[model samples]
Each structure stands twice: as structure tokens, then as C-alpha cells.
Target: MRLFFGLDPLAGDKRAIDSWRQRVATADGRPVPPANFHLTLAFLGEVDERHLEALCDTVDDLALPGTGELRLDRVGYWPRPGILWIGPAAPQPALESLAGDLGRAGQAVGARRERRRFVPHLTLYRGCRVPPPAPAEPPDLPFRFRGVTLFESRRGRDGIRYEPVAAWEGGGFSQR
Candidate 1:
């Protein structure tokens, strides 16, 4: 299965994001469904079915961060990936630590370590030849990181879908 470690925004957060996204011009690329919006921590490409239990156990053992909040205040576009995204307006050390721990946990379960540094952002659109226009006024999208989730990436005739397989909720200090 194609699995990854990520965070699912709460329902209210998702709705706020969807509303903000409607204001952005995305005529150049396919808009990612609000249901699939996630901030990926580790992309564990494909793994044997036998490793699922081990992966979950390893992740659960890690020191998951507490409730961390950040504003999705900046719009960014990556020309290589041909996608646009929104991310934290400032540095989020707690979120970064959580991702780092998850990455180490994934490696312990035999998943390959990602070479690139982690950049916390949610993809807004994909498969674009040119980047979409950014909103004139940046969005005030305050998001709280409540938990860590293991997601399975599935592909069918419809499109790609992310299904949560397991999750570990946070019950620690709040960071803003």
C-alpha cells in the first residue's frame, strides 16, 4: 500500500480553508479536493502489507507534539512540481519537531528516509503548467495541529484519495 504520515485539519479548519481557496484564481491547474487537504509529514511511498502494523506501532511510540497553531498566511508556488500551496506565515518549531519525529519513526519501520527538508504546506492545486495567481490579501487561516494520522493513498478511475488508517491524538501543551 502507498502510505504516508500526515495531519488532517479539523472540520472547521477545512471549511475555513475551502472558503479561503475559493477566492484564489486556480484556472491553470486542477484544484485538490478539500477532503484530500493534508500536511504530509512523511511520504512512505509503497510498503509491504506486513509492515503496516510495525509502522503504526513505531509511529505511536514516538513523542508526538501537542496542539500547535499556525496561520496559513503565505501563498507559494513550486515550478518544478507545478503546484501552488499555502503555508505558515512564520516559523513553527513545534510542527517541525513533530514532523522530524515522524520521519525517524518511519525509518525505524523500514520506510526510506526523505532527502528533502520538510516544508509544512498543503497543496492547493496540481498538474499546472503555470502557477496560479495569489490572492491580493493573504488569508488569515489559523490552523491547529491536533493529531498525527497515517494515511493510505489510493488511486482509481475517479482520482487519488487519502484514507486514514490510524491516528495518534495529542494531549500535551498548546503551542502558538
Candidate 2:
């Protein structure tokens, strides 16, 4: 099974993001679905059942801190122009450190971590469609991330269906 780790955006914030999705989709003559929003941390390729269990153990062992009360207030797309996401507001050090750990830990288990490095953003839409030309502006929307979730993506009839496998509380990391 294919697996990946990521931070899920709040449902309320997602409602705001869906507005942008609608605009972009309408511009492209299609309707972008809102059920596909997510902020990926690490993309782990195909894994056997045991390996999947190992990944869960890795997550449990690492116990990466969540980004408590984090902000995501910018919108943008990848260089290739296939995905649109909301960028975090200069991720806190703890958030960065936690992302680093998530990447490294995934690598430790033979997962291919992104080479461009993690920027921490919520992926609004990603598929075969070209992203609408970069927004000449930002959403200027303010929202908080109070939790994170791991998801599994499977291609469905309409598009990829993302199912939540697990979630962690306390988003921005613990002070300890």
C-alpha cells in the first residue's frame, strides 16, 4: 500500500480555500473538488503490510510534535504548475525541526523525501490540470492549524480520494 505523512488543514479554513478552488476550476472549465486538500510532510512509496506497520511504529517512536496554533496565510503553486497550496507564515523553528525529523525518519525507512526541501503548505488541488496562472496576489486569509493527520491517497472515479489513517493533536510543537 502507498502511504504518506502530512498536516491536515482545518475544515473551516478549507471552506475559504474552496472558494479559490472554485475560481481556478471555473477558469479551467472544471470544478475543483474541495475534499482533496492536504499539506504533505513526506511521501512514502509502496510498502508491504509489515512496512506500513513499521511506518506507524516510526511515527509512534518519533512522536513528532504538532504545530500548535500555526498560521497559513499565503497561496501559491509548484514550479511545474500542477498544484496549488497555502504557505505557512514563516514556519516556527519547532515546526521546521519537526518537518526535518519527519523527512529524515521517512528516509531512514527507505522513503524518497522531497529534494527541494519542505516549505510547509496545504495542497489545495493537484491533478492532470495546469494550475491557473499564479494569483497576482495572496488570499490574505488568516487561519490556525491545531492538528495534523496522516492520509492515504487512492485514485477514485472522479479523483484521488484521501482517507485519514491517523491524526495527532497539539499542532505547533510542545515547549516541554
Candidate 3:
């Protein structure tokens, strides 16, 4: 399955992000559904069932740092990927550390390391012909990450959906 590790935002934060996306998204791009909104820590790509189990176990064994709030202030776009995203105005140390740890764990379990530096952001839209201009000011949204989720990416009649296969709360792993 197509797997990735990410942090799920609180319900209120998701609503706020969806509302902001509705305001800024142009008609040309496909806006990411609010339900699929998440801050990805590592992209594990495809993994077999056996490897998937091992990956989940690795996460379960990890000693995650305390949960923290991530302030997503800026709305920006990556021209090459044609993705519009929202992220913090400055570096978030706790978030960065979590991502780095996850990346290392993924590598240990045979997942490739992402070449680009980890820039924590939640994607708002994709496949845009023209990238959206950065917002003049920050969006008022604070995301409290309660846990890390291992998501399975599936394509259905509607579109792509990210289904949580397993989850690691601040304490331990749980089936979802």
C-alpha cells in the first residue's frame, strides 16, 4: 500500500484550515479535502504487508517527545509541485525534531529518506496551472498535534483518500 507518516490536526484546527482554503483557493486548482489535511513527517511510499507491520512496530517502540502546538501562519506555494500549503512563520523545534526522528525510523525499516529538507506544512491544493501568490499576512490557525498517524493512500471513485492504518499517540500505538 502507499504509506506515509503524518500528524493529524485537532478537529477545530481542521475546520479553520478548511475555511481558510475555501477563501484562498482559486477555481483552477483542485483543493485538498479537509479530511485529508495533515502535516506529513515522512513519505514511506509503497511497502509490502510484512514491511508495513515492521514499520508500525518501529513507531510503537519510539519514545516520542511531548506533544506541542504548531502555529501555521504563512500560506505559500511550491511552484514545481504546484501545491499550495500553510505553515509556520518560523522554525518549530519540537515539530522538526519529531519529523527527524520519524525519518530516521523509516530509514531503519527500509523506507527511503526524503531528499528535501523537512518543511512542515499542510497541503491545501494541488495540480495548479499557476501557483497562488503568498498571502500578505498569516492565517490565524494553531494546530495541536495530538498524535502521529500511519496513513494508507487509496484511490477511489471520488478521488484520493488517506485512511489511517495505525496511530501512535504520545504514549503508544493503537489500531484505527
Stronger candidate by lDDT (1 vs 3): 3
**Shift in Å, residue 141, candidate 1:** 0.6
For 1-176, candidate 3 gives per-residue lDDT tens digits of 88888988888889988887676645357889889989998888877767877777778777764466888887778877788888888987776787888887778777878888889899988877786765544587888876788898999999999999988776765675
Model 1, residue 99: C-alpha shift (Å): 1.4
Weakest lDDT window of 10 consecutive positions for candidate 3: 20-29
Query: Taking the candidates one at a time, how many backbone clashes does each contain?
Result: 0, 7, 0
Q: By summed lDDT, which 10 consecutive residues of candidate 1 come out lowest?
A: 167-176
How far does residue 141 in candidate 3 sit from its true spot (Å)?
Answer: 0.6
Computed on alpha carbons, the lDDT of every model, listed in order, comes to 0.79, 0.62, 0.81
Query: Between prediction 2 and prediction 3, which has the larger TM-score?
Result: 3
Stretches of model 3 off by over 4 angstroms after superposition: 25-27, 65-67
Candidate 2 wrongly placed segments (more than 4 Å): 20-32, 89-91, 127-137, 170-176
lDDT of 2 by residue, 52-161 (tens): 55565566656555444456667666646566567666756666677777667667767777677667776665542655665654565545555556677788787667
